[model samples]
Target: MAGGTDAGAGAAAEVPGLVGVPLLGSLFDLKSDSLGTYLRAQHRHGDLVRVTAGPPGMRAELYCVFSPEGAQQVLASEAANFRKDNAFYQEVRDSFGNGLLTSQDEDYLRQRRLVQPLFTRRRVDGYAGAVAAETASVIAAWDKAPDGVVDVSDEMTHLALRAVARILFGTDVEATAEAVARCFPVITDYVLRRGYSPANIPRHWPTPGNRRAAAAMDELYGVCDKIIAERRGAGAHTAGRGTAAQDGPVQDDPAQDSAVPGGAGEDLLTLLAAARSSDDGEFDASELRDQVLIFLLAGHETTATSLCFALHLLARHPEEQDRAREEISRVLGDRTPEAADMDRLPYLTRVLKEAMRLYPAAPVIGRKAVADTRIGEHTVPAGADVILAPWVTHRHPAHWPDPDRFDPERFTPEAEAARPRYAWFPFGGGPRACIGQHFSMLESVVALAMILRAYEFEAVDTEIPVGAGITLRTDGPVRCRARRVDG
Candidate 1:
């Protein structure tokens, strides 16, 4: 089916929305409860629904698509008609600049080509041992702690940060880890908060929140710059991994061998430093820093957030946890999980898919209509905002039966293949989907295997407190009782 709907001459009709109170529109509603308000609008309206936000002068209409067909239309079919220059990307670029996530057109293509090799399947798999090591390093701290409540959210956050820090920047970034951990949340939260708000204040204005965000950004970028400076300045020095090492294993890319500079290093900063264009040009300081910042911030935070939810879901559903643990026990036993073992652990993979389906780390994918476009039969005006919510779409009863239940079997090969492509896009779809998705999933699977194998998690609360931001995050923290496992 073409986008799962047949569009006709009615393309000029206006998309539906509430004629809200005078100037406010849905500003208060979205600001107060974005996730709730968004889902409700989709249910009450239809798959392709319209929601308004902001005051009269700055009134904005957003098209929220919950149908896979609609998602395919914007993300795949007519993707070129949409651009990433939406409010969300604009604000986020404050931290990411023109990195892959924010860059478009030729810039995006070039940078994507340069950075794509780092996340190739073979490379990511090679990094698995490192993922396990980093995760082991953080969770090991908890092994000796007294039995009590730990914010597993905080735990995963630290684990994911340290894992990405070393994996991407190598051991040298270990010193910058604490500072980056402290600062990035501020910067990212600020960017996300602004992205969701209907009314946006100017960054040039000295707002307290903006000032705090700016300061956090400085600290965040300072760390990135330090890593870049150190990597480039050292000539051939890397923490421990030599220049000859590939970031992972060389998969299929011929560019990998030559893309890297003189076999000096393969950590992200080193690779970027070594990366040369067809023109034999190296990135300037700003260009290099931008890519690092995106990887460092987006790389860790999104996975950490997903990991936090996955652990929480398993904690609440002991049966699912037990099933997954059984699989881990069978495949991994008392041994640690390596990337090579991933394909052997099918059930563990399903558990992750189900968890992400319920609580997608990136709940909404935002785009702007660059030209008038037809989403289904409706004409979306140029400059209008388009939002695809994996949060809502993943729960749509049309595609998913028992939408709220914790069921991993839905992700089994037979079941997943039965659904449409965009029906369960946790990392998004089409060309602009998350570049680090493979890397993120591998990190999560490795961490999950290790955590399940070593510990038993008891939920302190049945209700999950969720907040929407640069990524979906638990409002305060996801607390659980942790007890180390014994053979």
Candidate 2:
């Protein structure tokens, strides 16, 4: 087994001079929102500190080994030793089934490979027009009521949901959007509650929240099933028929049989229907349905949360926001940005990066050690839960100077090069890093550019409450006043 430091060779090096109560060690302080208390303990106790929670064997620990060397050791050098912990995965599994985020080992790898291509730059870029169109529509709607206070969070949620729906299902997303939206609050609320209490109860004897969550999940899945059925039928209709390669019906093309290699690119449903296993195995309809549901559920909400935070930050920091808007105007005068234009929007990119750094959509990523391993100088037990928190690490003063300040300059190419590789992990790290990262980034940039070009946003309130569950978000509604930019 590996170890961080050898204070005295054979013993689990007790943190130097740090004291804790018999039970309920640091839980009270932690729950009371004392980040400094925990951070101070880390500073005083060295790299690793262990403290008992509410009960014996209910221990909580903190590890400050988040440097590039430590991140490489945990994420790459000894990755096999880590797996999703039961406590964390249980909550995600209960809500999302064994989707990419919750699945582990072989299953996770397989699903990831299959889904990876969908998030490639080419594929993601393909949706640029859809993103721009949807964002424009939302902005237009907002323009209708300039004087009224707008709940920007709600606006972002709807906009992101619509954009993702178009990308995944193609055309007329109204019904599906309604179904998914109906279930979102329930899923979000349940996930948040489970974080505080990591126990399981029978679904049949559900609490009111659980019952609603379960029902919402069922309803959402029902919508996915219907979409899959429709696509499957379409696939069947096109399977045997010889269709034209381009600009004509399948039956009309000269080389119809060989024209379109594999699946059609018309929509996500078509892609999934045509997607075949590398081993020539066919995807069952249910698997396709589950995957579609996973994409919609996971993709939209996370992006929405991040965008909401980004808007709030921009409104608060007007100079940064102005810089971003100026860059957008310079790059794209009156034209909507195409995929190629993303490369030119440096300030907008920085704004998005800084926003995500402050409030990562998925704040913490955790894994359970499968075998004894040394992370830095600490000897992690085989079953110990290891957590790498972007929320915490992204703001670590050692890694980032004046980390709390909303500074987009930190993301400049020169500034970025100066930092450690793993110092800013807004989308996580290693082989399990988000496949849709580029896609999400592209979408965010485009959406922000469109909004900025159309409106000048001002903070309606100075004080905004923040909270975190699956994603960091404003506790109450975030209202902003948007004045249309002068022509």
Clashes of each: 3, 9
Give the TM-score of each candidate: 0.91, 0.87
Q: Which residue pairs in candidate 1 have backbone atoms (N, alpha carbon, C) closer than 3 angstroms, thus clashing?
A: 243-263, 243-264, 243-265
lDDT values for all models: 0.78, 0.70
What digit string (tens of lDDT, one per residue) describes model 1 on residues 381-416? 778788888889999888899899989999999998
Off by over 4 Å in 1: 1-13, 144-146, 197-201, 236-264
Quality of model 1 by C-alpha lDDT: 0.78
Residues 397-450, model 2: lDDT tens digits: 777888889998899999999887878877767877776788788789889999
Against the correct fold, how does model 1 do in TM-score?
A: 0.91
Q: By TM-score, who's the top model here?
A: 1
- The 10 consecutive residues of candidate 2 with the worst lDDT sum are 243-252
Q: How big is the positional error of residue 428 in model 2, measured in Å on the Cα after superposition?
A: 1.1
For residue 353, model 1's alpha carbon misses the true position, in angstroms, by: 0.4
